[model samples]
Target: MSSARRHILIALDMHSATDAGLSTLVSIARRLDATLSGLYIEDSQLMSAAGLPFSTEINYLSAEERILDPEELLRINRLASAQARHLLEELSARDKLECTFAVESGKVAIQSLSIQGCDVFLPGRSRKSLTRKQVTLQLRQLVLIYENSGIFERMLEVARLLAANGMVSDITIVSETPLPAEITGKLSIEDVRWHFQAVSSTRPEQLRALRLNSASLVLMPKDLLTNLTERQWFELLEQLPFPLLLMD
Candidate 1:
């Protein structure tokens, strides 16, 4: 790892901005001697819809329809952002790390990828559409998405760091091939519990089989998603019920 300071950016949404995720990021920041920051995205789609006279909202429980007030949405956005900032501040203070946060108006992924200086960008998970239960962040089962590239090492390094801070019982690499002996040997010597799951390919379906609830963190290389269109990118995220550590 470089001795120079790095910046870690976390993208936040209303449903998934939990303290557990923020604490994990703060721990990583402490390990890397990096600064921490957050981006709270106000959904552009909802905001635009509010401008239309026909836009209305239905209560999921009450089945009642009402006009979608832009003011109400803006108020909700500000409240969410403030709550996120409060969580970050509380963790940063407890960890003795400097942290900051901001609000952005756009799609979460687009706004997240637009920022260039962050060494690690965590694209926040929106509320999952699937009926499966969501898992809280646990650093024990570290999961890394493998690409035949140099980014795996970086992913492993971050995973190991999390292991050191938390009780990481096992590390799993989702790759088509086994890791090089050099890396595997080090893990063995360190007595770290680890395993590999072989896949025929890195197709979306194969990747999706490794469900989000079982792992503590999913380390995905940005290059693997470089070819994904905006819609495709969102589809992948929607399936993930946990925070995704997007490695650049």
Candidate 2:
């Protein structure tokens, strides 16, 4: 592990509901002395389908017009960009961490794929098909979830308290497959070395077996929880002897 600052990217939608995810990113960034980048992707396809035309002029037409003028599109883009900047600025003020913002027009997954050199992607907890597809495709990428809102500071404090108590040791990064060489290479450079391990078994029984064999905390991104029924997640939580940290 190296001492380089961690680079965290938080996927933003500018919705009030995403505060939890944003806070999580802020907390981690502050604790690690990391840089936090906020990302907001404007779904161009959705805008187009909604009758907004991506043109160069603002055409104020009736609802029947069915197309957005270039001016209208530009206005909307500007608003989104301002919202993203405000979110990052607020988080930076609260967490006292270095922060930046990026607003892009494209599909979220495609935009995320193009982002390079990020330590982790922290996304809000939503049952969106696009989110699922993106996470599935980027299986090797490290991800954290924002499970709920209004607890960013608490989460950071918890992480720090855990570290002090020696509870944040021997982390197991679970997945159904091995991580790509590129991701592993980056993880290798992280300075806070804890016996970083992984379990590729997808079956519940297999995961339980592995848990019994190691005395490490089990960590999984919250997005993965959406794929499982509430009962299933609860069962795993109850059955697993070790503490489970859900990064949302």
Candidate 3:
């Protein structure tokens, strides 16, 4: 058995929802004997805006007059918090893994801050709407997404394939700096030292060097690609040399 504790961070939201994301996290955590952390960012702006009451009770309303009210915001926050807790509990129960929850108020990017010592990030993939600018930013390590319902099985298959081909021995999970709170809270370099041979610096150049030297395949959740324009998508494709396994 591996001695290192694998760490994973999950982004909790309403659309893609938390249940599926937590399910994936638990599965991965169990396989790696890792702990999971759940983060729910309460975008002050979004919450504030969504809290507004409708201008009129009728269905048709003027766009300019529509505004969120405090009651609405409270309701939304309650629902989001409930979902986040439910997921955390479920994952904790299944794997006997430690879990933590955070509800912060900030921009989406700020809320998505990295957890220190995390090996991977599991985020939900949704087709509803995309944040164009957010998708362009470079993120560290593997970004697991729910492509279809069967993504977990696919990942297992991929891991098995790599193991069979002797490629698994060379693979390692890496992350950028400012790791998530949950990771730093529960683990240390000493804990992971045996399982991961090296820790790459957070710099882009260092990351590139590590990827070239250590990894044969880089995995990311398909949702990371959702909001990109064709040009952006092609650019990302060109930049990556390894075959990306897009989890469904």
Candidate 4:
């Protein structure tokens, strides 16, 4: 619902992979003719640990343990945030992606939910999974979970651009309900298809069976997540085997 126009969000962090992925992000943006946005999340865990009286840091260069107070953490966060924003500015400039940027403070997963008004979400990296089985994300398919038929056209339009990104093999819609007539009227895809997964009538399980995909990008509507607690969603973002995107 952001615009009749399309928008895509790309996340950034202190990691090098984040900057490395900007070209890929811009490629998708250009293909969709979508505006772009970047969100740099301040790590809440590091901040919390910094505030503890017993907090300490190990000097990676010196191999020494040192005090890591809140002040130091804040300083580190400022530098990291600035670097992230700079990268966003530089890479988004490679194309006319109509890019914008922002910064937020919280647990990364929790903080990312604050980003709004976008069509697709791309996490810049395949972050560590809590499951710890060393799973890899497959970016060859884009999975979308939509709320209603009204958003169907927007979904497919975004899907088309994403699928041609050299990695995505196709688009898949995981639906609990039948397609509304308006959507079905215009829907056709050579590779894109809808897969049915049953859910509790009152509470749909849109995120279910998602872990089966090895290295895919899974997208969902931000407003349609009715069955999960914030913590549950945060954990899902952290532990999912693939890159997860949530649209607003």
Candidate with best lDDT: 1
What would the C-alpha RMSD of candidate 4 be, to one decimal place? 6.2
| Residues 1-248 of candidate 2: C-alpha lDDT, one tens digit per residue | 33555566665443321444444445445655777777786767655655643423232233243344555655766786686677668978876888877777775544543566553343433322233233222222221122233332233333444454333432334445555554445333222343334455544444466633112333443334445544664455435443233333
Q: Model 2 off-target regions past 4 Å?
A: 14-17, 52-81, 126-248
State the C-alpha lDDT per candidate. 0.70, 0.47, 0.45, 0.59
* Residue-level lDDT tens digits of model 1 in 115-196: 7756545534534332111232344577777786777777777776666755466788887777787766556415467888
**Candidate with best TM-score:** 1
TM-score of each: 0.82, 0.46, 0.46, 0.68
lDDT of 2 at 175: 48
List the RMSD of every prediction in angstroms: 4.2, 14.0, 14.1, 6.2
Candidate with the larger TM-score of 1 and 3: 1
Mark the regions of model 1 whose C-alpha exceeds 4 Å error after superposition. Answer: 56-67, 121-137, 189-191, 203-207
Q: Residue 141 in model 1: shift from native, Å?
A: 0.8
TM-score of 1: 0.82
